[model samples]
Target: MRLSGKRASQLALNAFIVLLLAMSIYPMTILLFGFTKDSLTWQYNQWLPALPMWFTNLNYAWKQVGTAFWNTLFVAAAATLGGVFLSSLGGFVFSRMKFYAKEIIFYFIIALMMVPAILGLIPWYLLIKELGLLNSLWALVFTSVFGAPIFGIFLLRGFFSSIPEELFEAAKIDGCGNFKLYYKIAVPVSLSSLATLAIMQVMGVWNDLVGPSIVLTSPDKFVITLALRNFSMSMSGGGMLTNYPALFAAYVISSIPLVLLFFFASKYYIEGLTSSGMKL
Candidate 1:
C-alpha cells in the first residue's frame, strides 16, 4: 500500500516531536528515578533505575527538611506578584498613554538589557548593604518585585499595545478613572501576559542561587538551592553522609511547584507570546 505524501509527512513530524520531547525529558527522568532508586547500587549499562526501588530518599527529604521550602515559596510568590503587577502597569502606560520622550525613555531602559547581569552584582551588593537588607529575603524580593527587568516590561508592553485604544476611551467615558481603567479593563483582559510574567518572575526568583548565596549568610535564611546544596549532600547513604540519590530527590522535590505552575500557566504563556503587535 502506498502512503499519501501528507500522511508520510505527518508521521515524520510526529516522530521528530517525540524524539525532541524525549531529549528534553531525559535529565528530569534521571532525577525522578533518583527519588526511588538507591545511589549505592547502580549498573552503568542500565538506563533506567533498577526495580524494587523504595521511597526512602523522598521520605527522608520530607521529614528532615528545614526552612528552605517556605522561604523559597514566600520570596517567589511575593516577587512574582509584585513584579507582574508593576510590569503590567508599566506596559499599560507605555502602550496607551502619550507622553514626551516616551520612546527615548523606553529605549534607554531597554538598552540596559544589553548590559551583562554580572556587571550589576557589585552595585546590587553595595545597594543591599547600604539599605541594611543583607541576610534578608527582602534583598531578593527587592531585586525583582517593585522594579521589574526590562524584558518583562518589554513583553507586556507589546501585549498591551495590541489592545484596542477604543476600549480605554469607552472605559474613561463610563467614569473609569486611570487606576480603574488599568485595574479593571487592562488587567482583566491581559491575563495571558500576566501569567507569563508571573511564571517567569517566580522561576527566576525561586531558582536564584547567586543572589541568595551572596546576600545571605545565615543557614536558616537560605533559599531552596543553597539549602539543598548544603543539606542534600549530607544525607546518609553510600557508606557516607553524601548520597547522590538523596540530593537528586531534593532537586526533584523542590522542582514540583515550578513544574505544576508551568503546566497550568502554559496555555496563557503561549497565548501571550503568540499575540499580535509584539513590535518595539
Candidate 2:
C-alpha cells in the first residue's frame, strides 16, 4: 500500500508526539519503579523494581511526609479559594459595573504585574514580620491571596466582558441586584474559567518553596517542598546517598495531590484554556 504525502506526514507527526510523550514520562516511570525496591535491591539492581515489593518504604515516607502534605493542602486550598473569589469579583466589577476611572484603575492594577516579584521580596518579608506573620502559614496564605490575583483578574475580565448584556438587563428587570447577577449569572457561566484559575493558584501554592522557606522557620509549619528537600538532604547524610527507595517514595507521595487535582478538574481545565474570551 502506497501512502499519500499528507498521510505520511501525519503519521510521522503522530510518532514524533508519542516519542516526546514517552521521553517526558520516562523519569516518572523510573521513580515509580525505584520506590518499590528495598535498599539492598536498589543498591544491586538500580533499575527495575525487585521482588517482595517493600511497601514499608511507602509507610515510612508517609509518616515523614504526611504532616507537610496536609499543611500544603490547607495552604493551597485557602489561597485558591480566596484568590479566585477576589479575582472573579474584581473582574465582574470591571466588566459589568459603571465606576469612575475604571479603566485607569484596572490598568494600574495590571501594571503591577510588570514589577518583578523578586524586587518586592525584602519589602514583603518586612511587612510579614511587622504583621507578626513570621513562622506562620498565614503569611504564605496572605501573600498568595493578595499577590497572585492580578493575572487571574486579567484572565477573567475578558470572560466576564464577553457575556451578553441582555442577560444582565433581564436579571435586573427581575429585581436582581449586582451581587445577585454576579452570583447567579456570571459565576455559573464561568465555571471553567474559575476552575482554571483555582487550579493554577493551587499548583502555585503547592509547589512554592521560597515563600514557605522564608516565612516558616519551624519544621511543624513546613510545606511539602521544603520538607521534601530537608528529607532528601537528611537522607543523603553529607552527600552519600542513603535510602533511595524511601526518598523516591516520598517524591511519589508528594505528587498525589496534584495528580488527583488534574484528574478531577481536567475537563474544566482543558475547556477553560481552549474557550475563546469573546462571545457573540
Candidate 3:
C-alpha cells in the first residue's frame, strides 16, 4: 500500500529514533569486541576488523573482576535493603502519625538534604573515624544509611498520603494495631512506590564510588567502582594496556543488574514517580 504523507513522516521519525538508539549502543558493542581482541593495536583501531572472537582470556578478567563484583553486590544489596526499610518506615510515620515535635524533626531532616554533601563529608569522615569504621565496608554502608532519606521519605510520604484513610479506619475497627495497619495495609498498598525506591537505592549505592573511595582502604573490601579506578590506575602505570574495550566490558558488567531491575520494574517505577509528584 502507498503511504500517506503524514504516515511517511511518522515512519521517518521512527527510523531516526532507531538510528539514535543504535548509535548510543554502538560504543558498548565495540567494547565487547575489544575485550576479546588479543592485540592492543587491533583493539585501539577505529574500524572493526574480521577476526575470530575468543573467550579464553575472559578468565583473566574474571579473576579480579569476580571478587570486585561480589563485593560491590554485597554493599549495594545491604545498603538498598537497609535504606528501603528505614525510609519506608519513616515515610509511613510521617504520613500517618502526629506528634508534638514531628514537624520540627522532619523540617530539620529536610534541611539537611539541602546541605552540600561535600560540606558534610569531613564531619562524616571524622565521625566514622571516631567509630573506628575506616577500612571497612560497614563504613560505607553506615555512612549511606545516615544520609537523610529526605527525598525517599518525601516521595513515599506523598504516596502514602494518597492512600485512603478509610482503609486504615476500617482496619482499626477490625482491631488492628498501628503495626498491623502498617504491615498489612500500608505496605501492600504502597508496594509500587517501595519497589521504585528500592530500585533507586540499588542503582545509587551500586554505582557509588566517592563514599567507598573515602572509607574503604582495604583492597579486599573494594567495590566495583573502586576496583575499576584501581584497574585504570594500573593501566596508566604501564602494568596493563589501557584497553578501552576491557574498561567498557567492566562497566557493562557492572551496569547489567541495575538495567535489568529497572526494565522489569519500569511500570511500577513510573507509577510511583507520577503518583509522588515527581517528573522522572
Candidate 4:
C-alpha cells in the first residue's frame, strides 16, 4: 500500500510539472498559432493552427523591422564585446593586482549598483545630448558599454580571485607579464563567466525599449523594440482595428535572434550563471 501511494504521488507530481510547463508556454503557443494563420482565419478562430502558412505576414514585418533589426544586432553585439572586455579587464585588475586604494575603489564601483538606474535617466539624457549623440546608435552602444559594468566586475572579480595563486606564480616564474597573464591565463579560464556577462549585456540591450526611445528620435536609428512599437501602432489603425497575425509575426521575428543566441550559447551561459550563484 505504501509503495502504491508513493507511485501515485510521483505520478501526480509529474502531472503537476507538465501542467505548469504547458501554462508557461501557452502564450507562446497561441502566438505561434496567431502568426501562422491569415486575418480571416484568426478573426474566425482565435486559436489552433490552420492550413497554408501565411508567409506574407513575416514579409511585411520584415520590411517594417528590417532596418531596426540590423541596428539592434549591431548595438547588442558591440555592447556585449565592449562590456565583456572592460569587465574582465577590471576584474583582473582588482583580483590579481595590488594597487593603492584598491579596496576603496572596488567598493565604490560595487556601491553604484545599489542605486536605481531610473534615477540617472535625466542626467544621462542630458549628458548624451550635450555630447551631440542624440538619435545616434553610438549613443546606445557607448552607454551600454560604459554604464553597465558594475555587476560584471563584481561577478568576474569573485571568479578571478578564486583562481589559484600557484598558476600566476608559475606564469611569473616563466617571465609572463601582467598583460599576458591576463589575456592568456585569466581570460581563458574564465570564458564561462565572460560568456555569462556577454549574454547578459546583449539581452539587456536587445530587449530595452525605454532607453532607445529616450535617446533615438530618428526612425532609422530606432532599435527593434521601438520599430515594433511603431509597426504595431500603425497596423492597429491607431487602436481602432488590429492585424493580429502580422503583429504577432513581427514579435516572433524580433524574438528569433535571442532564441538563436541562447540555443547556441546555452551551455556556456548556464555554466556562467551557476558558477556565479545567479538564479534564473
Candidate 5:
C-alpha cells in the first residue's frame, strides 16, 4: 500500500523511539532476568532461568544486599523529607512574604547551583570529616542537608506564587496566623509540587555513590551504589567471578524502591513538573 510522506516520517520516528527505548532498558532487562536465575547465565547468552530459580536467587541477593538496600532507603527518605519541608518554607517566604533582601538572598542561593558540584565535593568531604561524621549514615544525611534543594526552592516558589493572594488574605481574616496558613493552607495545596521535589531528591540520594563512598568507610554503612560496586569488585577479584548472578539480582532488588516510588507518585510528579514548565 502507498503511504503518505508524513505518515512514513511518523512511522520512522516511532520506530526510532522504540529502538532507543529498548537500547536504554536492555542492560536493566538483563539484570532483571538474572534475578530469576540462580546462576550467572547471561555470560552464556542465557536470559531467563529454566524454572523455579527465582526464590533461591532472591534469597541469595537479599542476604548480600539487604543492609545496603535499607540504608539507601533511609538516607533517601530522610534527605527528601527534610529538604522538602525546608525548601517549602523557603519557597513560601520567597513567594508570599514581603521581606527585605529576599531577591538577593534567593539569587545567592541559586548561584550556589552554578558552581560546579565537583568543585564543592572536596570542601564537603573536609567539612564532613571536621564534624567527625566519617563512616556514618549521618554523614550521608548531612551531606544532602536541609536547605533549598537545587531547583526545589525555585519550583516551590513558583508554585506558591501562583496561588492567589486572596487565599492568604482570606485565611488571615479567618483568624489564621502565618504558621497556621503555611501548615494548613499552603502545604495541603502544594502536595503536587512537594511530591515532585520529593521524588527527585529520593532518586538523587538513592543513586548517590561517590559522596557516600568518600564519607562512609565501613562496609555495612555503604549505600546501594557503593555496596553494588563493592560487591562487584569482590566477585571479580582474583579473576574468579563468584556468584555474580547474585550481584545482578541485587541490582534488580535495589531498583525496586525507586521504581515503586515513581509508580505511585508519577501522576502528581508529572503534573507538578509539567505545570511549572507550562506556567514559565
Candidate 6:
C-alpha cells in the first residue's frame, strides 16, 4: 500500500529506531555466537561465525562456572533477603510511627547514603578482617547487606507512604495488632515494591566485582564476575591468540541467570514502580 507523507515520516522514524536497536544489540549477539563457535578464527571471516554446532564449549564452561555461579547466588540471595526485610521494616516504622529523634535518625541514614563507598572500603575491610570474614562469601554478603540500606529504605519508604492510612485503621478496628497489621496488610500490599527492590539488590550483588575483588582473595570463593575477569586475564598473552570462544562461552553462561530473573520479574518490576507512586 502507498503511504501519505505523514505516514511515511512515521514509518521512517520507526525504521530508524529499529536500526539503532539492532546496532546496539549486535555486539552481544556476536559475542553469544562466538560462545557457541568452535574457533575464534571464524569471527574474523563471517558476521555469523560457525558455532561449535555441538555443545562442547557450553559443557566445558559449565564445569568451572558452577562454583562461581553458586557463590554469586548465595551472596545475592542473602543480600536481597536481608536488604528487603530490614529496609521494609525500617520503612514501615519511619512512615507509620511517630517518635522522638525520628527525623534526626532518618537524616543520618540519608547522609550515610551520600558517602562514597570507596571511602568506607578501608574501614569495612578492617572490620571484616577483625571478624574473620575476609576471603569468605560471608564477607561479600555482609558488605552488600550493610550497603543496601540506603536505597532500600528510600524506595520502601515511598511505597509505605503510598499505602492508605485507612487500611491500617480498619485493621486496628478489626483487632489487628501492630505486628499483625504490618505483616498481613502492609506487606501484602507492598509486594510489588518489595519485588522491584529485590530485583535491584539481586542484580547489584550478583554483578559486583570491586568489593568481592578486595575481600574474596581465594580463587575458590570467586563470584561469576571475578571468574570472568580471571578468565580474561588468563586468555590475554603477549603476542598470542586469546581463547575468545571459551571466554565468550563463560560470559554467556554467566549472564543466563540474570537474564532469566529479569524476564520473569519484568511484570512485577513495572507494577512496583507504578504502585510506589500511586497515592493511597
Give the top-scoring candidate (TM-score): 4
Off by over 4 Å in 4: 237-241, 278-280
Whole-model lDDT values for every prediction: 0.80, 0.88, 0.76, 0.89, 0.81, 0.82
**Quick one: ranking by lDDT, best first?**
4, 2, 6, 5, 1, 3
Q: In candidate 5, how many clashes are counted?
A: 0
Q: Which digits, one per residue and each the tens of the lDDT, describe model 5 over residues 160-238?
A: 9989888899889999987788888899999999999888888889878889878888778888988888877877754
**Once superposed on the true structure, which residue ranges of model 3 sit more than 4 Å away at CA?**
1-3, 40-51, 237-245
In angstroms, the error of model 1 at 164 is 1.3
Clashing pairs in 1: none
State the lDDT at 140 in candidate 4.
Answer: 94
The lDDT, on a scale of 0 to 1, for candidate 3 is 0.76
TM for every model, in the order presented, reads 0.86, 0.93, 0.87, 0.94, 0.89, 0.90
Candidate 1 TM-score, true structure as reference: 0.86
Clashing residue pairs in candidate 5, if any? none
lDDT of 4 by residue, 149-268 (tens): 799899999999999999899999999999999998999998888888888998999889988999999899889999999997787663524888888898999899988989988999
> Which of candidates 2 and 4 is the stronger one according to TM-score?
4
Query: How close to the true structure is residue 219 of candidate 4, measured as C-alpha lDDT?
Result: 91
- Candidate 3, residues 182-268, lDDT tens digits: the string is 789888988898888888877777878887888888788888888878876765655344555555556667667777898899899
lDDT of 4 at 175: 99
**Superposition error at 119 for model 3 (Å):** 0.6
Instruction: Return the clash pairs for model 4, or none.
Output: none
TM accuracy, model 5: 0.89
